[model samples]
Target: MTRPETLQASSKPNYSSPDILRQFYQRLFPFRPLFQWLNHGPTPQPDFQNREFAFVLPGGAYIRYQSFLSADLFKKQCVQMTPERFEIGPQYSINPRDRKQLRKASSFRPVMKELVFDIDMTDYDSIRTCCSKAAICNKCWHFIIMAIKVVDTALREDFGFQHILWVYSGRRGAHAWISDKRAREMDDAKRKALAGYLVLAMSGEQGKKISIKRPLHPHVDRSLKVLNPYFQDEVLAEQDPWQSAEQAERLIRLLPDKDLTAALQKKWDSMPGRSSNQKWADIDAVAEAGHLSTLSAKQLVDVKQDIRLEYTYPRLDAEVSKKLNHLLKSPFVIHPGTGRVCVPIDTRHLDSFDPLGVPTVTALLQEIDEWESKSGNMSDEEKAKVQDWQKTSLKPYVEYFRGYVAGLLKEESKGKRSREEVAIEGLNGMEF
Candidate 1:
């Protein structure tokens, strides 16, 4: 397999090239496993066959309503068109291509899709002092890390969802795809309710006052507990969002009592250079020493908790999670801007995931060439055992995906059998 010319040793990687994209789709992209994941079994089903795919072509044309009968057909289209990226939408009731032929337009609709949540770094712009608008560093990435911890915990412990997949968006954000049968089967109303349950039901903008109930909701309590540790280390220390006196006012406004905020402001005013950590501490110190709080003790406590949540809670793109037909970028697609493959983030080792360290398309191709050269002494049988993805850094991610798909298929098989048993039992109960 000759490598694409774009991966030459001297030249820089150009992911936008159609030839390079073609090679990537033909070689590294994990279409079979992806198909098995969406199809929910080895064989084609409505989950995969009737699914809608939208592609962003190399020339920047966005084409939607594309459907494929099999994994091979999907791969063929990807390799032929060499799209910059493709998006996965819900499985329609009828084949997307045949929708126009249907007598009633209302009959053509999205049925099932994984409930997804998006956490963009842009959402954290006001809270994070490090970077803004599509730029992220390790220090700022803790926000994402904190988000995953809180949201993942809620999805599992609160909602009892079993299979959740988190993927780095190949740039300054991460996406969550919950693949539990119950999750996928939920309608738009249920999706909205679930998303609303997770995301704070308050104004998320900066310099605005955010309030929380006195007795915290169980979900909110758990999220707060999960976020408390990171508040000091991630937000107050690393982000230092209120380091400047001008910025400190944002924090001051959240306090319920005017006298308390004035005292806290006065303290922070004298020491403008105090870090966010110190300023946060000064809230308690000033409130106690000056006796300025008009709020009850519980109200003061709730106010502080609200302040903590304001800075640390996951700022999800709730709109993305509230719709069944909203298309999200496909896993393993190369982000044209970053040249990185959008790999799944293994929650088992969540804290250690380094988005910046993910493999790029050109580098993965180079790995294949290097491995072929290094294995000159190996027998044909030995070399044939390994897939191209196995020869590169992409092996672990693909293997993880394969394993996840296998588990899903097994559960889906069980679900089918259980439903069949119930139906047979109902027939036996019927009188002739």
Candidate 2:
């Protein structure tokens, strides 16, 4: 397929400073319908210039939309977050190994021309009462952003998806674009089921009795490609053509009922080998034995939530203390490892600051190195005293780095704390 035009050469207006976020919001208000998928609430009032939105994820890491997808034809065609004024969505897709490259090429994809689906809380009008905490509370924005990744993984692993596009709603939540041709023909039931699959919720009905594990209970790794008959061909040009709609319909008819569970199982059976299919059957047996039926396609896939606070700027950083102060004034510490900005209950309003500031790690580290160098040549006892002072003085900096790293690992399966958080915790406990 031909690649889209280069966004860098285009003359689309871009904003690099936070001061312009207000102006951008004004520009975005008129396009509210354009971002209806955000599900934050009634289209934000035009007066939302100074308001902030947190581009967050389920992993607890915020989406960093530094010049996010401006080139996406979808956004451009959608007429909401056009390249002319706003850069809608995260600056880059989640290809972590190329993190540096994405950071360097900071810009939004052209608003995608293709269709997109957004998940948000149905009750956006009552955001304050609804999303009070991190876990129990519901933040549609976070749910939408994070849920898409889970869906993307599912599509690529269970189905055969090579590319997907995403965009921010410029308010709360986001819009994701799937480039796969198969996506267009999906029925409402399948779409809804797909949505539920990605949300990854525990089976509330069964409570402790039900077990909901991710990456699917059977693990689609390696065996997944069998579902795509196109891959079986040894020669590149000899691959089986994608199933026509008529053909797909006929094949689908041969399956059982189209309920979420049945559809999912049908998809598994669509693959080549019955041996791998048995694994899915075994998985179902385990679920049934454990009484985990509540873990249906709806709870895990269908996501309907609202995004509350919209944020702009790079990822969470140490100096963000000053910036987020306007939103919450909590006595907060940013953990570099997780990039989670934690506020002590005593200083909960740390976000009240007008214009937030987030310092880069390089800048923070340089300051620490300078301070250490200046204190060199001192006696061990004197050095110990200085070390104590350093800890007290740089506590915020340490927390910032720790949380930042932690945020990076939000997508990983391991439940372990980030190495930086552990180190900081150890350092925090150390005596002078």
Which candidate tops TM-score? 1
In angstroms, how far off is 401's CA in candidate 2? 30
Which tens-of-lDDT digit does each residue in 288-398 have in candidate 2? 444334455344231101000101001111121111111221112222222222221111222121111223222334455676677777777886654321323335433
lDDT of 1 at 79: 94
Residue 382 of model 1: what lDDT?
100
lDDT of each residue in 206-237, candidate 1, tens digit only: 56788676578998998888899999888898
What does the lDDT come to for candidate 2? 0.31
Q: Per-prediction TM-score, please?
A: 0.94, 0.23
- For all candidates, the clash counts are 0, 92
Q: Give the C-alpha miss distance for residue 60 in model 2, angstroms.
A: 32
Alpha-carbon lDDT of model 1: 0.88
